[model samples]
Target: MSEYDKVRVGRLVLKGEKLKTKKRKHKKQGRDEEGTTVRDEDASAHGGWWKTVRIEEITGSIGIEFGNQTYVKALDNGLFTLGAPHSEGEGPAPEEILTAIKVNDTKIALKSGYGKYLRVGPDGVVTGRSDAVGAMEQWEPVFQDGKLALLGCNGCFMSVAQDDDSVVAVSKTAGKDEIMQIRSSTARENENVKELPAEEQGSLAQVEENYVRKFQKFQDKKLRINTQSRSGLQKAREEGNLHEILLDRRSKMKSDRYCK
Candidate 1:
C-alpha cells in the first residue's frame, strides 16, 4: 500500500462528550491491490487510529488548539503495544489507577483505573494508549475517537515533534541541542557567501585602522601650521615689523633674512 493509503490525516477531538474528526474527505478511490475498503477499521488495522487525525510533521511538531485549550506531543513514537508489563507502585497508584506500562521493555508511563486511557475507536478496539509523559512536563496526549493528540505544557524549550512509520517519543528532550547546533554550524556557511575569502572579513577592521592613522597624520600637520602662525604673529608684534612684513608681500619684495 502507498504510504498515505488508509491514512486518516489530522486531529480528532471530544466536544461535550462527542468525538469529532477534524478532516473532511479530500478524495475517494476504489480499493488497492488488497480488498481493503476505506472503512475506519481498515486504518485502525494498520496501526493507525480510525477516528483520530494523522498529522505528519514536515519541519516541527504539529500543534492543535481547541476552545482555548491546546494539546501537543511528539507524533513520531506512538503507543506500540498493549497488555505490556507496567511499573508497580510508581504512579498515583490509587486502587483506581495503573502505575505504568512497559514500552520496549522499559516501564515508562501508562494510564490506570477503568483503563479509560486504553482508548478505542469505531471498532471498539484500543488503537493507542494515553499516559502521563515524563520530562515532557505539561505535554500530554488526548485520545478521542481513534486518534491521539498532544496537549499543552508550561515550560518547554524548542520542543521537537516528528512522525515516522513507527515509534514516537514526545518530550522537551526531543530535538534538544539540534536547533543550537544547526544555527551555530550555519554561521560558517553564511560567511562563505561573501565574494572574498574568510580571511578577508578581518581585512575590513584593518582598513578602518589605516583610515584612523591617516586622519591622525592630517590633524598633526594642521596643529603644526596653527602653532607656527601664532609664533610668527607674536614675533612680528614684538619687533614692530608687522607692517613691514605686510608691505614686503604687497610690493613683491624678497628678504631671505626674514624667511627664518
Candidate 2:
C-alpha cells in the first residue's frame, strides 16, 4: 500500500504513544513525592551511584503469530519483527516490522509480566518495572478476589509508612489528587471501517472503473483471436484436405489456450 493508505492508522498510534508518554511522566513525579531521591556526592562521575527515584510501572510482552512458525522479535522501541533474523538479534528489519503490524489479518498474543509497586486497577492491572516508590520497600496487598482495595490514607489515630500502595486512594497524599484514573486498552472503536469521504470515494471508484475497462478489453481481444482460429479450422475441414485427427487437435488447442 502507498504511504497515503497508512495516514489514518499511523495517526492514531502516534497520538496514543504521546498520551502514554505524558501519563508515564506524571506517574513518575507522583511516585517521587512519596519516595526519596539520592544524588551522588562525588563531583567526578566515574564511580558514583546513579540518581534513584521510586516509580510504579507496568509492562508486558507481545508475541504475534503471523502464520506457520512465524513470530515477531521484541525491540526496545516496542515494535516487533516479521521474518527470521539474518543473524540472531540483529533485527529482521524495518520492512518486516511493518508487515507484522499491518492492520488486517494479523493476530496478536500478549503475555503479562511481573507486577510493579503501583497498581493501575483496584487489584487488576499491575504496574511493572517502576522505581518511583524509592527504598521504603513494599509488601503485596492481598486483594481478595473481588473486593475493592482502596488506597486510602491515614490510620486509626494513626501513623504508617506514607509510601504504601494504599496511599494512592487517600485524598491527602501529595500527588494522589493528580493521578488520572484511566482504563487501559479499553476504548471501544468502530470495528467496521468508515466510508471514505464522498469526494475521495468517487476518485477510488473512478480508478476501479479504469482497471475494469482495461481487463475487459484484454478479454475481448482473447475472444476475437479464438473466433478467427475456429473459422480457420472449419475451412481446413471442408476442403478435401480434412484430417480427422488434425480437427480434434485443433479443438484441443483452443481448449488448452485458456489453460496455458
Candidate 3:
C-alpha cells in the first residue's frame, strides 16, 4: 500500500524542483558527430521530469508480500540496493526507479533510474556504472515455489547481506539463514552474538570450560557437606543422643541463615 508500489515502468517522475536556465553567451561548441550539437532546453532546466527507465522487482509477489520491500536504487554514482520507499507524488526514491530489463533469453539487467547499469565484482561486491556493459551486470532470476528469490549472477545469488555496522552489503550467495522472514532485503544479523573467527573460536570453548569447572566445584562442595552431615548424624545415633543431634541441627540452621 506504499506509494512506491504504484510506480511502474515508462512513467515520468518529477525530481526535486524546477530551475530556470541562462542563455548561452558563447556558441562555438565542438563535439563528436553522434554527440548533440545543442543541449535540449528541457534537459537543461530542472523540471524534475525523471522518466522511469526500468522497474526491477525484488520479489515475485506483485503485492506487498514477504520480499516486496526489496528494491534497487539508481543513484547518480551507482546502483545501490534499497528497500520500499515512502515518498509519494513529490519525487521518486532512488530505489523505486529502476528498469529491470531482459538482456537476453535467460539473463536480465537492472538499469538505474538515470540509465546506469548495476554491476557486480568477482569478489561479490556490487557497483553501478553509466557506461560499462559486461556480464557482471547480468543476472539469472532464481525461482522458489514459482516465486522469485532474486537474481543470480557470477557465482553467487544477487542477495543483500548486512554486516555488523548496519550497512547493507551487495553480497552474492545461495541464501542466508540470518533472516527468518523474507521481507528484509538485508540480512538481519544478531548483533548480541558474534560468530567468532576460527582463531577466536577457542575463546568460546574456554568460556564453556570455565563454566564446567565452576559447576564441578559446586557439586564437590555439596557432596562434602552432605557427607559431613551424615557423619554427624551417625555419631549422634551411636550414642543414642537425640538432644545433641537436635541441637546440632539447630546450630547449623542458624549458621546457614547468618553466614554470608
Which candidate leads in lDDT? 3
Model 3: per-residue Cα lDDT over 48-165, one tens digit each: 2221112233322111112322334444566454445333222234444545566766666656556676666655556667365577677665554434434445555554445521
Instruction: Evaluate residue 213 in candidate 2 and report its C-alpha lDDT on the 0 to 100 scale.
Output: 34
The sequence of per-residue lDDT tens digits that candidate 2 reaches over residues 1-260 is 99998877533555446544444444343333333333333211312111111111111222222222233333333322333524322322332221111111211112222222222324222222333443221222112332212232121110112343221222332232322211111112322334332222233334233323333244335421222223443455356443332334334434323233
TM-score of 1: 0.16
Worst 10 residues of 3 by lDDT: 178-187
- Model 1 spans > 4 angstroms off: 1-37, 40-51, 54-111, 114-170, 173-260
Backbone clash numbers for all candidates listed: 14, 11, 4
Local distance difference test, each candidate? 0.29, 0.27, 0.42
- State the local distance difference test value for candidate 1: 0.29
lDDT for 84 (candidate 1): 20
lDDT of 1 by residue, 99-176 (tens): 223332211233434342323223222223455444322223333454343433322222222332222233333232
